[model samples]
Target: MPPGSPSHPALTPRRSPLLTLVAALVIVEALILVGAAVYLLHGLLVEDAAAPIAAIAMVVMALIFAVGVGFCGWGLLHRATWARSPVVVWQLLELAAGIPAFSGGSPWVGVVLVVPAVVVLVGLFVPSVSAQVSR
Candidate 1:
């Protein structure tokens, strides 16, 4: 088909595999945050938690962050260009948090946190993934 024709591949952008992977990773991260928020809420409501107010605040913040990340992942799935930077920023922040977990005597926690961050970070930059989102 002609380059600018309706039948042209470029005219109908397909989601690349790497982009799908990135979106899935981001969504999973958001879900994990939501789970953490639920845990905080449970502790605040059902357990003798320290500083209940702080725990409530933490739960609120976690839920907000989870919603934001979930939206970003949805945007990425739809190939929205604006979603890319926020997702990248999130992965950077995740890496920052994950690295500290290692020295905090939680190597497994560090690995769980770091692996997806690294995967999404690399996937976002992959040529196919980058091009897909840019469209």
Candidate 2:
């Protein structure tokens, strides 16, 4: 088929409001991860007591999540069906981490993580959003 054939899906899918919100949330999460990575890297450079290995590990962790989740969000924005599973898995992991943080005396951090996870979870599962992405 030709690149612009009528039967072919457009490179950018029509986005529902919920899907837009989901994409925004995912992007925000990616930005947060990047910010953390930068902070860790800065600490690694400046803080003498900070173990270099631990700092590097933290930066790597942040980069992994930023790239992985960010790619999933980008794919979701393009309406790729494959994006949904990884997103759901990421949200589940976020929820799992949030729950422990919530009970571990850092209620604020838990709320910050959990609220978006819950919102994304609900938004993704909405019938209209799901249908649009699946198509």
Using TM-score as the measure, the top candidate is: 1
Counting clashing residue pairs in each candidate, in order, gives 0, 0
Off by over 4 Å in 2: 1-13
Q: Which candidate ranks first by lDDT, i.e. highest? A: 1
lDDT of predicted model 2: 0.87
| Per-residue accuracy of model 2 over 72-125 as CA lDDT, tens digit each | 889878778998989999899989989899779999989988999999999999
- Work out the TM-score per prediction: 0.90, 0.85
- Which portions of model 1 show Cα errors greater than 4 Å? 1-10
Candidate 1 C-alpha lDDT tens digits along 40-99? 999988999989989999999999999999999999998899999999999999999999
Clash pairs detected, candidate 1? none
RMSD of each: 3.0, 2.7
lDDT of candidates 1 onward, in order: 0.93, 0.87
